[model samples]
Target: MPRGGPVPEFDTIVIGAGMSGATAARLLADAGQRVVVLEARDRVGGRMHTDRAAGFSVDLGASWIHGIRDSRLWELAQALDVPTIEFTVGSFQAGGRPIADFDGAGNRMSAAESARWVADVATADRALEEAISRSAPGDTYLDVTERALDALERREDALDPERIDEIREFFRHRVEEQCGAWIGDLDAHGLDEDAIDGDEVVFPQGYDELPQRIAAELDVRLEQVVRRIARAADGVRVETDRGVFTAAQAVVTVPLGVLKAGAIAFEPSLPAEVADPIARLGMGVFNKVFLQFPERFWEDGVYAIRALGEPGEHWHSWYDVSAISGLPTLLTFAAGPFGRHVQTLTDDEAAADAVAALRRLYGAAVPDPVARWITRWGEDPFSHGSYSHVAAGASHHDHDALAGPVDGVLHFAGEATWGEEPATVGGAYASGARAAERVLGRPVDLAAFAEGIRRSEV
Candidate 1:
């Protein structure tokens, strides 16, 4: 809460004005504490950027609400009355081919085929679960999957070897898409974190609105790229390009990527518990290539497109996000290693590749794009990569260590610090609130802050 009269310093200095910092600052200030939010970029939302360019409001970063029930974000969305849209899974790709009908539902995988697949996919899911259940500590998801796949192949009723491979690749891509890392990098034991149960949704207007609203009543200083954090006689001293500020306490909400990159220097050096995780935990790569075409060439009612037969893993998923800009827009994703590889391409190269992939699926009717926006989170200085994931041999307890306070001088908050919902906006915000509580020496209901949120008029 950047609220309060002019003061020489502050009671708390919240670093990085993303969802986490914004929530921490707001909660602390409302509780009568002086707080200042320091953001590296000249904006409030960190990775939740709602890029307004070429007369379109497009989210270059996060867009979806993975789960809705018991969602702090959903509660806040309701309080703010943010406009939302639901995109049901409408297409599938089997053996590298689209099951969606081009003209209508007639070409789609038939009901019988759909039922058959449902059963097969269900079995695959069960295999994954069983593998996870029997996995040894420190085992990677890939290891668990291999064991499951081998057992399935030995089953008398197993499908052809090619089909089995397809199923394996399907789950591999899924984990890559969801965790933002290859299956080999995922820790089998850390996979099943708590989650909300409900339909998935996205902000058709812009996901950035949530952070913008939460930070409205607070004082957020933009373009203040933090470089170093140190313990001071008074409290904590934060050094930024613009200047320096000292506060009674500091809450760092920067992305785990930033920490992993050693961007901010710590004064006495963080303890082994914190430093170990920062070194061992994985920072994943996930990029987006949003293309706005001259006209819609794909079928209507298709929310997503997945092609297992794609030559490369670059185009992991394509989400139709025309609702945001009312244009013929489709945003495709690149995850895992390809997510990193795509960063090497020039803008034209990347956009052209995305269009080429679309052509393969939709035919030559796919025209040249009108406008394009691409991201390379792996190259961003502030956020070194997309997000955090529990890497192989890394325990979910790593999140706990990252969140743990250092010498009662430094507190932590970010998606990487929360295990239940790591890599999620809601989890980040909750971690912020929790950090603020630690400084306030009290407990506060997170739901109470939902009232301060509202959708922007845009």
Candidate 2:
């Protein structure tokens, strides 16, 4: 095929050069199939961008390798000789001081009281599980979460009203972050569907390295935004901004947010099973704001500091990047509704809010950051939000529908399609491999890749 000649037909066309797409392209190409990857952005790593800023390897997109055991990401990192460090959640801070719990009036809970609160929260969780199991018609996760919190509040008589309100706010933030949706919009039953067992690990070299390594030898077409996917009787035609590419099989690896936004129009239109899940499944926003300081100001051994604030506040959780990156950097996270709200603010405004929140903890003398970076995944055309979650009335079956292929022509692969581990790089990698297996008509031994990680641990 010449450069300007008719678009060369490939055995498979993988869309969006993210973890899933890159993995699929690599696997398919290695299987002796001609593959071409189409990516909307100029870069190969879609939401796995790693850039050097202020002399530090900063991951602007995906950060954590998540799990080591049975993790494809961990396996890939091992193959590439990438270093990883265990990431642990640290202490909670309020009003610039370490505390288990704090009231609005600046009173902190004693160790005994904090222990009791933890027990109460556990009880509330059990109650919530029971409530979700026996949920009535029209019941929303928000209703159940509030009911659980109210039950806990009523049982804890020792706490003052102000203290109770503060605890409630904290619980709200925790639930929203876990569900990746506002309490009112989350499905209580589906919250535990995607839970995976294991400690999270960080890629010190940068999370993007895994995808970049996989896509190194693949024919990836950058800045080719796909507009329409028309499946004919014999093959599939992918119309992009640049040109049309035909392939016997096409794997759609774009983010759930982009799919929900209807960025690519299907010629025959997606069936109800696929389209309905796309509508029901929620696209979550989990953006990060990184601030680099000249020196570390926060305490050591504390990976995360919880800044007590009202519900839906943008800067509720602050991560100490100094622990892993060996740099004086504080990474703040905004998720769910708060994350969406933060996306609406200007870069300076969002940075100012995060700085003010930090000042509340560190005092007025906290020096201004020498460099700052904010990520707005919601605003990006390729990835409208961070990841995917089950909406209020949706179930895990929605994920199955999203992953299901249509007419053996169009296949879907992304983090959202992996119901067992949705919204993680590991899931995205597995999904891509699974999609390639579907095209190959045989199961690939993905578990074999993790043997190295298992042997290293032993």
Candidate 3:
């Protein structure tokens, strides 16, 4: 019913033109398969959008390649000859005053501070793993897991087993730094540990350039939001707001949230196992608030400032875009539950709150911004959130459930479905490649790619 015109046909149909779908479509098309990509938005790069209306480019979606050291996206940049700039994560200074390095005192955490956090993270991960391992691996997985985690909090190996609840509280606060704070409850626990690669890069020209360059020669139909998929014994029927399309195989690369939200429905309904993963895998909200001031206020030359707030508080971190290039832009990051709440505020309200937060740390010299831009991936219909991460007690196997194809025809690929590094752009690319490989009936070089992904963690 969402279809408007005649139903064209194809060998493969990929939905959502973000990194995952784009990669999947390109590979499939290059492999001599006729593919049609359906996107709800008017443009491609669903969450990797960059706006250049202002003098400089601002990423309305993904700003950085995240961690660049071993990133597949970084490798793609090299292959495509795309230029990039480094984004430094440095110390915190406000209003010409050294508030302190990264500490709970509302300053950028120092190397020591980061190491402390890392240790706590390692402890938390282990605690979760031990909880799962201790549980009997049968029908009572959900119940046993809950009990194990509750018991693990009392173990002496914990960061603060004596204060188990407080330890989980602190772990939640720190995970906000690693993943978006708005992530849902634990769906799958420890499959593997994917860390941030030492190298991280940002495109001075813009991240948007990469997708456009890769898609320049492809036949992309803009503004076609898919609404349904009717799979018959003969072929797969795809419906969208633009038109109807039919294909032998369909690779659905839309965000986890889109599937969970039921933006697109299936005729007979996809198997519960397939649909359940979407419901279980949570999408995280990471908001970036950018502002341009008349002049630079802090001179620490630090790339990032971590404002350690009380547990469960938002606006605890800020990035000095100026530090990277001495530009007039100031960008701040908010993740986790606090970030979800932040998505509900108006841009003006969000900016006003951020200004107040900065003023508290930086004094009055940092006046109101001349121009303000806020990225709210949470509320977007196409991508309900920015990226994906595991909840406590959830393992990588849960994600593998999403990876399983339906009738060897319907494939799922996205950052959320990646097992090694589930949230990065490189993970999305790798996931797409894996999905393509699945459709072609080939064994993926998981070991090689796993090394590459791990090498590029951020």
Number of the predicted model whose TM-score against the real structure is largest: 1
Model 3 reaches what TM-score against the true structure? 0.79
Best by lDDT: 1
Judge candidate 3 against the unseen true structure and give its global Cα lDDT, from 0 to 1: 0.67
Ordering by lDDT: 1, 2, 3
TM-score of each: 0.90, 0.89, 0.79
lDDT of 1 at 301: 65
Over 338-379, each residue of candidate 1 has an lDDT whose tens digit, in order, gives 888889999999999888876666667889998899999999
- Steric collisions counted per model: 5, 1, 24
In candidate 2 the C-alpha lDDT for residue 134 amounts to: 73
Checking candidate 1 for backbone clashes, the offending pairs are: 1-25, 1-26, 2-219, 80-454, 96-309
Candidate 3 wrongly placed segments (more than 4 Å):
1-8, 88-170, 182-184, 187-192, 310-312, 323-326, 392-394, 442-458
Encode model 3's per-residue lDDT on 141-238: one tens digit a residue: 23434454566656665335423443444445445545664222533342245555565677766677766655554567888888898775445788
* Preferred candidate (lDDT higher): 2 or 3: 2
lDDT of 1: 0.78
Quantify all predictions' global Cα lDDT against the true fold.
Answer: 0.78, 0.75, 0.67
* Model 3 RMSD in angstroms: 6.7
